[model samples]
Each structure stands twice: as structure tokens, then as C-alpha cells.
Target chain A: MHAIQQQYWAVRDYLSPVLKESKFKEHGRITPEEFVAAGDFLSYKFPVWTWEKGDASKARDYLPAEKQYLVTRGVPCLRRATSLAYTDADEDAERLLSFGDSSGTADEWVETHAGRGATVDSAANLGEIDDIPDLDGDGLASAMADVSIVSETGATVGETPDLDDIPDMEEEGLEDGEDEATMAPVVPKAGGVIDASQIGVANGNLLQVRTYDVMITYDKYYQTPRIWLLGYDENRTPLTPSQIFQDISADHALKTVTIEAFPHSSTLQAASVHPCKHASVMKKVIERMNAGVVEEQLAARKNSGKHQDKDGKKKWGFGRKGAKEEGVKSPVEEEEVEGMRVDFYLVVFLKFIASIVPTIEVDSTTAF
Target chain B: MPVVQFAPFASLVQPGFWHELTRMKIDVLRLSEDAITVNGSYSVGRSIRDRETGHDIALGCNLTVGEDAYQKAPQLSPMSVHTTGIFKNFNTIEDFKAADKAALINDVVSKIWDSIITTKDTSLLTQFLLITFADLKKYQYFYWFAFPAFVSKPAWQISENGWKQADEEIQGHFQLESIYDSLLKTTRSFFLVKEIGGITEVGSIEQYEEFFAGVAPENRVIGFLDPSALPENPGWPLRNLLTFLRAVYPSQTSSVRVLCWRDSERPTAGKPWRSRFGVVSIGEGDPTTKPSAIGWERHPTTNKLSARVADLAPMMDPKRLADQAV
Candidate 1:
């Protein structure tokens, strides 16, 4: 049955229609050429991501040698998904209603776990409270001020032993900074967009930290970028597959996330966020951002009316802010209906992905 | 008081670092296993605390190196300190596995010890070692990262309540910003912090000898851009620094204040940069005797003292890429 399903997928992938330029804006899918262009733009803007070539043995002819896939390593996952405030039913219902109004597909949001985005809202509350006293019962001030004797070790200042004579302190590794002491959870600032600077300094527990090495590959059949994740524990040890699942939202863990062998590597298996619904979701996000663009343009148009063409040279700015007027409603306005540039496709895609995996922190740098 | 146990340095090798190694292997370093100097960096620890679970998450204390690891001089960034390390890429996985890991670490530690006794550049104490074997055919890499620190005779101890937040001592954001800016300009990972007539000052590592002689012992504070986020502990780099201090300082019994200089890489409004101040006492070690070092990274899952593997075939394998492409 698995072999049959694989065959069916292969045939379906081969038969899938190539994304047309017109549908690219409407459907949020792209051709291989467009994928490269978008990848280039993303890498240019955010240097955190860079293109890389796979093994010479598995090289793809469609993409350039140096640009086979994109990767950003050591993306910190400060907390587990469950640690974030759960998406309340009311907020989920509100999101479903808005998604229905925009894309007429509300159930898709519930199915994909993409709508479990309560953390993104909380993430925005970063940087409001600056000096939170280390509420870790061991008071910060008292802990630093108190003095104690070190008579237990029995070694005085001048009569210390040589380094060679010292026993292996590997067992003492536990006492080293991996202290089990906990601090009061941080209450995020009430309202604001997340600042990239604050993303690294947020109130995260040092004991349970995890890091993710992320990979973004263009999915040929789905016509979208697919993300793969390999996580490591605080000690930089690789997290088991089940351990990785703990960081992923429960909604998407068993559903969309699949453990499969990556196409470029032969020996390793990684968890990949399936790209099946990426196109439609990306299309909805693009449209929403474009609507925001239109609203801003409308606001600009209203503001520009105050200045008017006082000099009579038609100094009025219209759609996209820089287009010239040629009487028949500038061609830029027509394009403005599908306003956002294809270069921003990956940015929007990441924003959608962030909602699904709120703790991974890959999108924090790119969101702005 | 408890022994000052340092948080181990976590190695975060960027994929680009491997890609660069691959390129150098094919184009420049074909069967060579010579030691090459590479640059790595660590920033102030950024962690979050969960008040609900009371779980303190250590965001990362990563000694990271990427595509720019091969650069001769660091392009200084405000967020992190660009420290130096040695990289040895073996030709085969067997060579990587069979090699005497202790001897390899000792060799690097010996070099660090030599530099500490001879060089004025205290930055030399921050040296680390990395070994790897890239299986180009399989797109896999077997690697180990070790941050060597000599075992002190009298283990360094954190005096009771020895560490506290230094937001006030440093004055405020303006002074902290100035100090952070100076840190980048000097490019020294470790420095001497002195208070000259109520005005705080930071000096390069070379000045520690003179600074220690001139200042009162109570005011002897050494600062490093701390990589560990945990409040009670310092990062792995401090281990070597402490060892170096014991060798060079004039006093046999030195009670020095340690400033774990931490700040947000990009300071946003309302979020001020903060640091920690701790008092630690180090006893003199026998300068002639070489200390046993510890810093081999543990294997992620097996929890054994073994090398970790990374398979990049899906991204690096050409045939696989082609097959995945439309």
C-alpha cells in the first residue's frame, strides 16, 4: 500500500501543472525560475539564510550548483509549543471567520494547525518590561551578596595541587551552569509587533533550550518551499524524533509533519512540514498583505489630495507611490490589485509557517 | 560557597561552514589534514523563563562559525565576540574515529598554555579545537568540537551570592553602549575593568598587568562578553581565562571580580543592556605543570564521548537535488 501510494504521488507530481505567471499572484505558486528568484531575494535581504549545494552525487540539474537549497542553522527554540499560551477557542473562531472572509476556506486553517497562532500575539509583547528581577526564589541580590566558606574542598590558596594530579571532574558537569533553578515566567508586553532585536533577548529558560537547524527546499510538485527541521537539545545533542515532536504543536505533529528521508541526503531522516497546502495558504496571506497595501495606498491618496497638483504638472502620486499618470488609470494601478512583489513570497510563506511552529524562532529575523 | 563550574560551550556549525570546507577540499585542501585557523564567535546569552513551569530556557551559548570562518581577521559585529580556534579536517571517518582525541585536545591546550605564558594578547586564552571528516560521497560529516580549559589546582569557587545584575553599577544604557562599542573596536574578548575616580573604564588584556598593579585588589574586575545565560554560571571561555589569570597575575591569592558582560545585540527601546558582576577567588597553579583539560562535546543522543554526524546529502547530493527538482 505504501509503494502504491508512492507511485500515485510520483504520477500526480509529474502531471501537476506548472505555475503560470498570472496564476502566480492569484494562487501563490511559482515556477522553478521564480523560486530561485524569490530565494535569491530572501537571502539578499536576510543574510541569515544562504543557498547551498548538496552532494555531487545528488546534484539537481534544474537548479544551479550553489543554489540547490536554503539553510539557516542554530535557530533557537526557546520553549516548547505547549509552553506558549494555547490558542483560545474564541480567537480561533475569530481567525476562522476572517480566513473565511478572505479565502472562503475556514476549515483548512483548523486542519493545518497554521491557525494555532496565539504565541505570535504574545511574542509581540516582547521588550515592554526591561528589568524583571530574577524571580528565581534564590533572590538575585541576596545570592550575590552572601558569603560562605569553602572549607569542604580542603585546599588552601598557596598549597594547591598540580593540574596533572587533579581527578577528572566530568561528573561535576552537572553542577556547571546547567542549574535546575527556575525563574518566574515572563509576561510579554501587552501590544506591539515583534522586534527582531528582542527575539534573542526574550525571557527564555536556559535549562530547556533547544536549537533547530532549518532547511528550505523548493518542492517541485507542490510548487512551494518546504521546510525541514533537525533539532538539538540544550547540550547540543541531537533530539530524538519524538523529542522533536514535543516542540511541534500537537495539532500538526501527527497530521502534516512526516518523518521522511530528505531528497538530497541519503543517510538522514528529518521532519518536514508538508507543502501540500502551502500554495493556497500562501495565496491567502499574499492577498491579505496586498489588501494592506491597498489600504495604505488609499490612505496615501487621501493625504495627497490635500497637496493637490498645485504646480499643475500632475505631481499627484497614485498606485505604488511612484507611477506616473497617463490619464487611463496608470497601468501600475491595474497591477496594484495584485500588489505584493513575488520577491516577498518567501517572507509571507515564513509568516504563515511561524504560526504553525511558534517556538522555532526561524521567522523572527525575517518577519519584518 | 560552591566551585565555579562553567557551562560548556555549545558548537553550532552553520551549513555554510561545511560547504566552505567542501569547496576548500575540492579546490584547495584535497588530502591535507593540517591544522587551519578558523574564527568562531559567541554572543551574550539570550534566554527566556517560563513563570508557569518555572523552567529557565537557555536560548544558546553557541560558539558559532559559518562561511566567514576562514577569514584572516574578524569582521567585528556588535552582537558577538569573534574568537579564534583551530580546525583539523581528516581525510576519512576512520581517521576521525581512530585518532587519539585526548592527545589532539592536549596539543591545542598546550599551545594555549604556551601562548598564555608568553603572549600579551589575553585573547589567546580563548582558543578552541575542532576536528572533522567529511564523507563527500555520502554528504555526511563526522565532527567533534572541544573547548579546552585547564583543571585548576584549587577549583575556582563562586563566593556566596557572588553574582548580581550590573545594570546600576555600569550606570545606564549610555555607558553600557559605550563599553559595548569599545569592546568591538578593541576586538579583545577579555578585558580589565577599572573604576578611575568613580568613572568606570575598560582596558585591553595587555593592560591587566599594569591595571592590577595600580588598582586596589577589591577593584580588580575582569570582564568578558559572557556567552552563558544562566545567572549562577559563566560560559566555557571563562575556564581558560581563569587559568591564564592564575599563571600571570602577581598575587598568589587573587580575589578578582568577574564581569559577565551581556547585552542585547540590537538594543531596542525600553530593553536596556544588562550585565552580571561576580567575585571569584583563584589560587595559583604550578605554571610549570601542564593541566589536564576537559571540553570534548558529548554526542547528542547517545550521551557518549563520541563524534556527532550530520548528513547533508538531501541538500548537497546533486542527483537527489535533480530528482527533487521539477
Candidate 2:
């Protein structure tokens, strides 16, 4: 296995602080606007030099006459998406086979935990939040609390970040006559849009589009991530067949070929790459960025230690970047450099999706 | 042509391997660098609850292997089911192992486990079973220590008097975790033989036991003693394995199946084809009275042993087996 295969969660962990937290607000997800706001907030701490893909000279011939300026519009794009979570083929299979119908599972759980009074199905009717007081305080209570607390949060951009403080656990706060066996709060997935109108649209279009239409949904049978590339121009016009076919690389063009006789476009446009190496592209970007940090640290160390300093603590590279007050490097510089690194990572991802997809703009100014 | 249910005709089971496993990580015994192992420690996941016990089992030691394996002997290349053919030879599909067979394995297993008790719906049992059933059979015998069992109540329930006594004994036995540390053993299980006042001696008559022990009697456990050494008398191991199980307990208890496949001459063709067969043995006491006669029936479709895993749940209960009689 390549180094990147193992570094997926590590990279996700490294980028999670600024990119997205797994959950938010009683399972409430961050609105794209809110996610962008949080990204802005993090940018102040670890800023990336983000820019737009606007080079009229390098514009391809397929560019629409109306939206050709998307290249030259200079809309100040930073590679951003509201949220993403990774799952491999095995995990996807186990989850689907084990608990494909979550409602049935919930009914079973409620039946077991609450006995007959309220099933997990009916438990939802009892109230939004009900606390089944954990008498022993051993496993279920603490575990439910842990699951509830992990509501992948990406706060609305410009809004104060509430990522640190998990929403209050609604306890016996349930009114009398309510009995839900204390079902976890239902986290509304998707549908959070960043009103890019606030951020300013390019030309007449929303500079950013947050759409799951282009997601890499894992195919259970194939045991691969079947990437469905959205077929649309920046103007939202669906692309013709030839237009779609033109987007993919010759080597990966086999993805467009139909495997089954189904008339569905899903099989036609989507493709499966080697799952093990998919993350390598992202890892390559991080490696380059990490190297920049090391180089900075080395440069910093060399400048300070013309002579070997007596104190070993001073020579340590960690947290030493941008220690500017005493002319020492500070960690802030490393984060800033990392910011550029992440932006380039995003750029690489866009290029990758572009290679897989025939239509759809990769670099959007608004939060995806 | 059909997926064969191989036999344990040739296998390496270091009866003492389980004595070396623990909870920290997946460990292995470097048995001469090439021979195989048929026993190890398995653990349950953290969030799983036992149906018999209200919490998850701490660690499942003294576990057995080849219980879920069905392969054509150990190979240099791993028998893993991959996604879209990675690290494979570009030309031939010789090394190519598709997910269809794996998916079929899952499909069949799911059909049986469709009726799991809701009370024990947790990660421990489900996760452990998935990994055990899904992962390809590696020749190295790695990860003797699997995952833990999660259930509301453990498999074995203690009586009111035995409850406190069982708790104390569990703490004394595992040695790692005291009962105070939220993590607790599901049950302290042991294999029972005709008791010699708890002396570790081979009883004249074999009996089925659920309790744990160092040297268990043969009726409760069955594995290869050496390479391809099939008893001159056919079905000897199968007959011995089932003597204690079929004599008592439900058919589900006898679900622990062992798979063995070896290269042998064809019955008439004389050309070499993979000869595969399995023994569906149920435990019954010494068959001297019952006449250790085992009947074999052909499966309707494929070449299957009598034990067809249809419409049944996986019997993943931890076990303690009796050693072979000297």
C-alpha cells in the first residue's frame, strides 16, 4: 500500500480543524454559509492564499460563449466544500448489510431498551429529546451521550463558532406523558446552503454551488466508489453526450462505457478508480505542504543557531514558527504555509474531479 | 466448480497458542515460519452488549480457528476479496479474486443471522462476526486476538448465588481487569467433563462443557493432530467431534463447522482436481452404545456437507474445547 492509503484519516484529522468537524448542533449540520463562515474564522488562525482560476489565455475551446469569463472573472475562489466523510468498501458493505434500514434497527433498540411502553418507531413521537436516566452509568448512557455529541459541525460562516460547546443534552426535560426511550436528536442531513448572495455572485451566476449531484456514492456490489459527475455547465445547462465524453482522460475513458444494459445515466457517466490509490493524490499535496513546513523549520533553526544554542528547548522546531517578538519563528507561519498547502490540495482535487467529469466547473468561488 | 466446503485434513493447531494472546493488539505465533495455527484469542467491540449479560465481554481468550474458514490450503498470495483489482498481474485473472464470492458468503451468512436478538444489538458481536466472516483466510494465522463481544447479557448466565461468585471468579480469572473498571467479562465459561473433582484428566466418557479450562476433553473440541493424517477409519474426527454435541444441546450448538481441502487423485478420472468435502459433526457422547455411525447426504445443488447454512443465524458464541484423548 502507498503511504497515502494509511494517511487518509490522519490527513482528515489534520484538515478537520479548519475544513469541517464531523457533526454539529444536536446532529445539526453546518449550512454551507455557516461552513464558509467557519472556514473564514479558521482562515484568520491558519490563513491560505486562495485565488480564482481565471486565465483567459489558457481557456479551453469547449468553454461556453456566455460563461467563458468564468476563467477570467477573478471571483477569488478557495477550494471549499461544506462537508465530506470517507468510508471504504468493507465498511460501506457492513453498514448496509448490518443496518440498512435504520428505522427497523431503531425499533429494535427501543423495544430492547424501553420494553413495551414506546418502541423506537413510536419513541420518536414521545418528544424531540427524552433522557432515559442511566441508572448504572456504565455503557448505554455514556455511549449515547458520546454518539449524540459527535454531530459533525461546520458553523455558518461569519457566525460565532459553537463547535467547542456541544448543545446541551436534553435530559428528563421531556414533558410528562412523553416516552421515547430517549431517542437521539434527529440530525437533518444535507440541505444547508450558504447564501452565496451574501458573498457576491460572479457575473450573473452564484459563484459557488453546493450540490450532492456530484458525490462519490459507494457502490456496494462493485465494492467501489462510483463517482457520478454532474452534467452541467456553470450556467446549469445539462451537457450533451459528446460534451460529457470529452471531459475524461483517454486512459480513464472506460468509465463512460456502460457495464450493464440499463438505460440509466448513472452507470454511463460514473467510473471506479483503484480505491487504494484514490487518496494518494490528496496525500501527495499534503506531503508537499508538509515539506514546506520542515524547510521553514530548518531555515528557522539555521538562522537562530549560527552557534549551537546551549538550551535544547530553544532549538526545538515545534511551536517555534512566528515567535516574531523575540525574532524567533512562529507556529502561525507554519499554519499559513499549510493553508496554501490545503488550497493546492483542493486545487489538485478539482483537477482530479475534472479529469473524471466531462461537465461541471471544478473551482467555484462560493462554498460547495 | 461450486464453492467447496473443505476439510481440516491437513492443519497445524498449537493447542497452547491461545495461552499467549491478550487485548492490546493482534498477535501471532511464528510456528516454524510456515506451519498454521488453529487457535487464538478473539475480543468483542466496545459498544456491543450481550443478551445474557447487560454489558460487553472483556476479552475472549482460548478461541478456535478454521471455524469460519473454507479455503484451498494456505497460499503465498493472500486470499482477500478486493474492490477493482489492484496490485494484480495485468494480463491473467489467475490472481484475481472478485467480491462476488465474498458477497455470496455475506449473503448466505446474513440469511441465517436475520433473526438476532434485539437486546444484544451492539457493535461487539456484529463487528466481530463481520470481520471474522468477511476477512480472507491468511496462512500466517495472525490476529489470534480478534474483537470483543457486545451483548446486553452474556451467553452464559449465572444464578443469583453464582452471580456474585461468578463476578469474583471472572476478575480472578482474566487477571487484567478488575470488576471495578467499567469493562467486565460477559461470563466465565468452561468446558465440563465427567468431573474428577475438577482434576484435569481425560474422563472415560466425554461430556459437553461451556466452562473454560487449560486441557479440555476431545468430544468438546476437534482439530488436526498432524498433516494430512486422516484416520485410517474415515469420519473418525467427525464422529468424535459430534459425540458430545449431538448427544445434548440444540442443532445450533453443533454449528461449529471445520473446513479441510487437500490435493488428491480423482475417484475415476485419475486427473487431479481439487477434491473438497466437509463434515457436519454434532457432539454426542461415546457412540459405543449408539454405534459411531454418521450418515452423509448430498446437497441439492452444490457439493455440500450435510450442514447447509440456510435461514440460520451465525453461532458466534465463544467456546472451550476438550483436547484429543491420548
Indicate the DockQ of the complex predicted as candidate 1. Answer: 0.06
**Candidate closest to the true structure, highest TM-score:** 1
Model 1: how far is A178 from its true place, Å? 16
Q: On residues A92-132, what C-alpha lDDT tens digit does candidate 1 reach at each position?
A: 42233134544454325542233333333434433322233
Over the stretch A189-268, how does candidate 2's per-residue lDDT look in tens digits? 22221122111122122122211123232222222222444233222222222223334333233333211101121112
lDDT of each: 0.61, 0.23
Give lDDT tens digits, candidate 2, residues B248-304. 333434333221111111112322221112323323333222221111211212212
> What CAPRI class is candidate 1?
incorrect
Each candidate's DockQ score against the native complex? 0.06, 0.01
Query: How far off is residue B316 in model 1, in Å?
Result: 7.2
Q: Lowest summed-lDDT stretch of 10 residues in model 1 chain A?
A: A143-152
TM-score of chain B of 1: 0.89
Residue-by-residue lDDT tens digits, candidate 1, B1-326: 67776766768876557777888898888999999999998877766533323334556567887667887764434456788888999997667766777778878888888888877356667788899989887666777788877777667777787677766545555556667677756645788777666666788767776666667766557888788776666777777787777777646336767888776443556654557777887555564466666667754434445566665554455444333322
Q: Top lDDT: which candidate number? A: 1
